[model samples]
Target: MFGLFKKKSEKQKLQEAYQKKMSEAHKVSHSNRTQADKLMAEAEEIAKKIDQLKV
Candidate 1:
């Protein structure tokens, strides 16, 4: 029998990645400007993916 869990989609992958980045940012040094910027950019991209899904 097949399991209930399914493969992750591109959007899900990006969203999960973005969430991980945000969590890392929160846990580590808050003054890490480079990581913060990168995470923010990733989050924006994830938002775009969400928009695509909504359409």
Candidate 2:
């Protein structure tokens, strides 16, 4: 009867998106915080962008 089930809540969607973005960012080869931050920013608009990754 309920074929049209509701989708994930806003919070869930945001969290999922955040995690996915972070994962993608981490996979990339970033030299410094300046670049890393930019990649991370793509995931969460509110989170501060990291310039470079420590790794």
Candidate 3:
């Protein structure tokens, strides 16, 4: 596919990472509240970076 030749931009990479962190946080929430909170915080930080990149 032509997509293979393309690289992700910084914003795209950060967004993907944020989504992944949120999903992990959701999955961990039930078994480990503390870890899930940590993941959520990380996702928040990533979200901030994504916002900064948008400007």
Candidate 4:
């Protein structure tokens, strides 16, 4: 499809990164609470950027 050749926008890339970080946090939550918290904090920052882009 033509869409395959399209590039992702900044927001879209950030969203994907956010999702990846959240999932990593979820997986790490069981083993290391501190690391998971760090990942969550990073994800929150990315979420904030996404929100700023929307405004």
Candidate 5:
């Protein structure tokens, strides 16, 4: 499909990154609180950027 060749937009990329980070955080949460928290913080920053792009 043509979609396969298309590049993702900045916001879309950020959203994917955010989702990935959140999932990673969730997986890490059970084992390491500190690492999970760090991942969550990074995810929040990405979410902020995605929000900024919407405005």
Candidate 6:
């Protein structure tokens, strides 16, 4: 597919990482709230980086 040749940009990569971390946090929330909180914090940091790239 043509999409296979496309490379992800920095912002896109960060966004993907943020989304992955958030999903992990949501899953962890069910049994390990502390770990979930940590994952959420990491996701927030990624989001901040993404925001910085926009400015």
**After TM-score superposition, what is the CA distance of residue 1 in candidate 6 from its true location, in Å?**
3.3
Please, what are the lDDT tens digits per residue for candidate 6 over residues 1-55? 9899899999999999999999999999999999999999999999999999999
Model 4 lDDT tens row, 1-55: 9899999999999999999999999999999999999999999999999999999
**Candidate 2 or 3, higher lDDT?**
3
Rank candidates, TM-score, best first.
Answer: 4, 5, 3, 6, 1, 2
- For each candidate in the order shown, give its overall lDDT on alpha carbons: 0.75, 0.61, 0.96, 1.00, 0.97, 0.97
Q: Using TM-score, give the best candidate's number.
A: 4
The true-versus-predicted C-alpha distance at residue 54 of model 4, in Å, is 0.5
**How many clashing pairs per prediction, in order?**
0, 6, 0, 0, 0, 0
lDDT of model 1, residue 29: 37
The lDDT ranking, best first, is 4, 5, 6, 3, 1, 2
Query: What is the per-residue lDDT of model 2 for residues 1-38, given as tens digits with 9 covering 90 to 100?
Result: 57478677656666677787787677663546666677
lDDT of 5 by residue, 1-55 (tens): 8799898999999999999999999999999999999999999999999999999
Off by over 4 Å in 2: 1-6, 30-35, 46-55
Candidates 1 and 4 compared: the better one by TM-score is 4
Residue-wise C-alpha lDDT for candidate 3, range 1-55, written one tens digit per residue? 9899899999999999999999999999999999999999999999999989889
Candidate no. 2 TM-score? 0.52
State the weakest 10-residue window (summed lDDT) of model 5.
1-10
For each candidate, give its TM-score against the true structure: 0.58, 0.52, 0.94, 0.98, 0.96, 0.93
Best by lDDT: 4
Looking at model 3, the pairs that clash are none
In the predicted model 2, the residue pairs found to clash are: 32-52, 33-51, 33-52, 34-51, 34-52, 37-50
Q: After superposition, which runs of candidate 1 have C-alpha atoms over 4 Å from their true positions?
A: 1-5
For model 3 the TM-score comes to 0.94
Candidate 1 overall Cα lDDT vs. reference? 0.75
